[model samples]
Target: MQTPATPKFTTREFRDVLGNFATGIAVVTSRDTEGRPVGCTINSFASVSLDPPLVSFCIDRQAGTFAAFQSHGHFALHFLAEHQEEVSRRFAKAGEDKFGAVEPVAGIGNVPLLSDCLAHLECSVYQRIDAGDHVLILGRVEAFSSRKDLPPLLYFRGRYARVASE
Candidate 1:
């Protein structure tokens, strides 16, 4: 195996560089073994495969909800709408009740589904790989919903942005 090369850029520099690329905000939700809901705001989500209907997202290894997501084996990814910045900020924090005000319905494998998103995907854990400082989770999409009328919430350069009306 080839050895990894040393990164010349500082962590802050790397983050700043990547932040130039905009990403849609998402809140990935799941239930713990005891059936309590958990979620976190994530912008690292992506569609991994179309043939098998797979999606993926990265979670910090030290996140408060990490263990629950890893063991539960199911989750739902909610793509936030442009008006859901409060929801995004709420989940982005490390807290016990990320779903405090939001009423989440149960999806596949009892994963909690948030409402009013531009889109959402219900998935089952397909695979988990160790990535630097995070875990890359691949999920098999089981169900999904979309509302084309709603614009997505976006993050760019450490701030929230919007898609201009066409």
Candidate 2:
């Protein structure tokens, strides 16, 4: 079968449409050559396969952490809780020192893992694909953890949102 052409949605429209879907917030963390922390806020995290335990997330082409993540070969994903919204926003900024206030310890190959996150996944770079203005990073999970008592931070309608009670 022939594939259909790409849809002609404007950038803003595409963003708005995607924002309608609620997603959990996460921080993708790595370390530099000097072992300094490097990370960025990302909401594009998702699991891909279960048998081999694979996951993926997207990073903007211009993000400062891009180089580190691309070369470091390992990283960690921290699923944020509702109380960690500030941590999310701090890392979202392009060049800010987001980790100055938070103390994160090393995990799997010294990837920085923040404390008190809803969940943590330590992964090694499995694949990297360049797509338009972003790069899709596929990671093979080697270690993981979760805190069942915390509520997750969510993103919807282009802003951070709280999970509602049942």
TM-score, predicted candidate 2 vs. hidden true structure: 0.93
Query: lDDT of model 2 at residue 137?
Result: 95
lDDT to native, each model: 0.94, 0.93
Model 2 accuracy (lDDT, Cα): 0.93
Off by over 4 Å in 2: 1-7
lDDT of 2 by residue, 63-166 (tens): 88888888898999999999998999999998888889788888999998899999999999999999888899999999999999999999999898997899
Estimate the Cα RMSD of every predicted model relative to the unseen true structure: 1.3, 2.1
Question: Who wins the TM-score comparison?
Answer: 1
- Stretches off by above 4 angstroms in model 1 are 1-5
TM-score per candidate, in order? 0.95, 0.93
